[model samples]
Target: MAHLGQVELLTPELDATVWFFTEILGLTETARTASSVFLRTFDNYERTSVIVTRHHTSGLRRTTLRAASDEALHRRVAALEAAGRPGRWIDGVAGTGPTYLTADPDGHEIALYHQTEWYSAPAHLRPGLKNQPQAKPRQGIGVRRLDHVNYLAADVLPNVEFFEDTLGARPTEQIQLDSGKVSARWLTFTHKSYDIVYTEDRSGANGRLHHIAFATDTREDILRAADLCLDNDVHIETGPHKHAIQQTFFLYVYEPGGNRIELCNPLTRLILAPDWPLITWTEAERAKGQAWGLKTIDTFHTHGTPPLD
Candidate 1:
């Protein structure tokens, strides 16, 4: 099995962006380097789930996935090599072991590795529950763990095929336009309905990010998060609403450096069947809006970072 490990986000306003994750989102700072600060949620076993890097612009730098074992890593690399797009093994940075780094066709960087550093929180942050990673954070929102990421692609089909072929991800849901074009797709390597997502980019831009999400426990948590975002002067993009496709309850906001971040709750339903049927949404159906008929805000469709020219 493959699972999301960590995500690297580039930000022009590094310090402020780090504050947003640590102070606002309630992730703990695990490590810091000259150019990056590694952060982890209270529930992530991995040393870090979000890496905020100093950069000239705002967008995703890379997203990492963990293979179940050394053999699984080799199998994935073999598939990559057969596709004539073999990636390179890179020396691990802080909080991670060696990684095989590659990029999707649209240019989003991907790192696959089997080794990782499990988080060992300091004394003050130790959890009361033996099974939890750290004590529940006391700051705003207090998101639980890194949930999923959504990417913007000029076209979505090639990415769907690329993930399916190389990583053994299976499609769980998608949007098929009236013209027979695929506008968006969701795939998962785990039983969770979806872990990574791609949506049509009307900006004609490739490799941009729509959002990266952190999981919260309940709908009440999400509703409270909206109040926190408003009080803290964060840009509320949309939600505290249910999604029709994955059934995710979501709230979106822009961090100081312009990258979109989402706070979401897990899907009520899991795709437990190995042969789970793909759920398809027609253009007309999608036009009807979310699960509760909340019309997805317009910006949710067009806005992505780094800002297009």
Candidate 2:
């Protein structure tokens, strides 16, 4: 089994974006370099869960997953090589060991690795509970850890094949168009319903990111985050509402660099059945809007970072 790990974000407004994450989003800075700064949520086990880097446009740069063991990492690499998508092994960066980098069919970069430096907070931030990563900070939204990420792919099926065949992710839910095509899909590698997601790009863009989500402890934390976004001049793109798909309580906002960020409570529901059947949503069912009645905003359908032509 492999777990969703660190995600690197490229942002044009590096300084302002970093401010938004550290000051308003309540993430802790773990390391920095000439081009990148690494950050982590209070409960992230890895030394750094997010990496903000200088770039001309704001969007996902690369996503990393941790293999369950060195043996697992080798197996995945060998499988990908046999599938004709041979990736290169790199020395890795500040918090991880050797990494194998490859891309999905849509050109989204992905890294698979086995070794990482577990986060060890300084004295003031050390948690009383040994199971915790760090003491919960009394600041910003105080998101727990990196959650799922949704990508906007020009076509969903090829990307889905990469996820399932190459990485061994199982689909938990999907949106089927009237034409009998899957327009969106959610896949999981853990008890949570989804670890990665792919949605049809209305703009027909390849490799654009829909959003990267951060989890909060409860629905109340998500509600409180909505207020925080308003108070801090952050743009609220969508709801403090439940999603019909995963029943996720979510709020979407744009950070300083224009990439969409979601504060959501997804851990409340667990997919425990080993043979959990796939949940398919028909086009008509999705047209009705969110779990309540909030229509999925129009921008959600067309807008993605590094805006497409």
Candidate 3:
């Protein structure tokens, strides 16, 4: 499984969104273009991420991440097609080395591709690279690298089939919740133990992001970062709790525009053996931290959680 490595957000307000990640949530500015700025958690986190694009409406209009090669990319696209899903590839997108466009439940576009060496940038953009003074004490927050992504779909079946058969990501867990006569099922995907996850929607925007998390070195750093968000009045969605798989204490903080950002520690262990069989989740396992009638199921287990459930 070639797991997800980073997530990029396209928003209208670049300055506001960047400030939220930098000052409030503590991310480092790795690279910046006239129209885009990328903040990373560390040099190795997601190869420089959290792209904020200047636009009119503030939301994730598009997203692009990594894949091993063009062959893998074609394999993924073919899988979606076989499952009776719609997907296409962009011949080439400037700034982003290469990419393919795919749509989710809310019709938001996702571009999956690999970047050229031009993207192997160092994360130390201090003392101001583009003629600006360096900001405050964020040595802990400088751009890390790509970690993983969590996406919400129209339904789980299409996404599960597309991801599993195409990209080689396998299910870490599956959730089914019953609310009166209606029941919902969601899927989790991992190159090893989930780099992307999707579930049913209960309200608000369709194709809206629930959250995207990056990994940290120590639980101390993660908790400290969460405190920074609270001090800055960034919304605290949830946090400082132990997950079933990764087992790391994590803090899920919402950015300036209500987009959830997770700052977490590395999983207790890494599933480095790519061929390791994907484990399934029991009913109680999937229901952890969930209630009936609530559509959200935390099937994801790679971002600072364990996998021995």
Candidate 4:
């Protein structure tokens, strides 16, 4: 795999969700169907990075990954089939070529593709700097690009192993409990530290999305985002604080669709060394709380989309 691509999010309140993403998050609406809307960040090279679809409830529908090359795509599919986890090929997906659809051990839908329709900004949206993908939005918090995604899994170790073995994802850090179980793990397919994360779901929920993050330029941008969330009556879940794990400066909020969203700046960290050692945090160390001692909120562990009654 090359990197994390688009994510399709199912929402009960499609209009409200679209409003939150465009009006508050500053994402540009590129296209809309009868039941879905496509959006992209200011710096995403692809035509769209987020797909919001109308559904009975809010949760993730699919997670798309871009393959490094056409040969890489075929090789990974062959590996999955050889491992007895075969998935079917799906064609005609919007803005991308034929995709191989599969599921992880926790049942999260995964789509892999190599060909893509790169975004070409319209004249009205063109950037002053030729290198930029599109003009920076003059409204709301202008997030630059899609960051990592966190999934809540019932068995973190199995999912972690599956991704590592089949997808060739490298583990960068993890949390290990005293019982010798990995409670959480961060994996990367690229140099940006982590592009995927699996955290143990105490609720035993399978196929649940914990949160999806977008990147900003600095910590000041996150603080401004917090103020914007406050003014808009959006639910601020937590942060404007640093995480002990990746050390990302973050501000998390619940969109109108009730899915968790994070705005973060990783400061200056990346997995540059090919032989980078994995950093493991013990349960005891985690008990001390976040980087600056802010206790992680209870909802952060328990709350997920399509709420479990």
Local distance difference test, candidate 3: 0.56
Instruction: Please give the distance, in angstroms, between residue 235's alpha carbon in candidate 2 and its true position after superposition.
Output: 0.4
Give TM per candidate.
0.98, 0.98, 0.72, 0.98
How much lDDT does each candidate structure score? Answer: 0.90, 0.91, 0.56, 0.93
Candidate 3's C-alpha runs over 4 A off are: 24-26, 30-35, 45-47, 55-58, 81-84, 91-95, 118-143, 178-192, 245-248, 272-309
Candidate 4 ranges with C-alpha deviation above 4 Å: none
Return the lDDT, model 1, position 94. 53
Residue 187 CA displacement from its true place in model 3, Å: 7.1
Instruction: Order candidates by TM-score, high to low.
Output: 4, 2, 1, 3
lDDT digits (tens) for residues 1-309 of candidate 3: 344544557565578778877765556666788988866543432345566767654445565646777777676667667766677667644345556678754565667776534433334544344333333345444323345565555455665655556666555545544432111222234433456666544442356565577766567777777677677777776666665544445677656544667776655555566455545445555555532223232433222110112
Give candidate 1's error at residue 7 in angstroms.
0.4
Clashes of 2: 0
lDDT of 4 by residue, 200-232 (tens): 999998999999999998899999999999999
Q: Measured by TM-score, how close is model 1 to the native structure?
A: 0.98
Cα deviation at 152, candidate 2, in Å, is 0.7
- Candidates 1 and 4: which is better by TM-score? 4
lDDT of each residue in 229-260, candidate 2, tens digit only: 89889999999999999999999999999999
lDDT of candidate 1? 0.90
Name the top lDDT candidate: 4
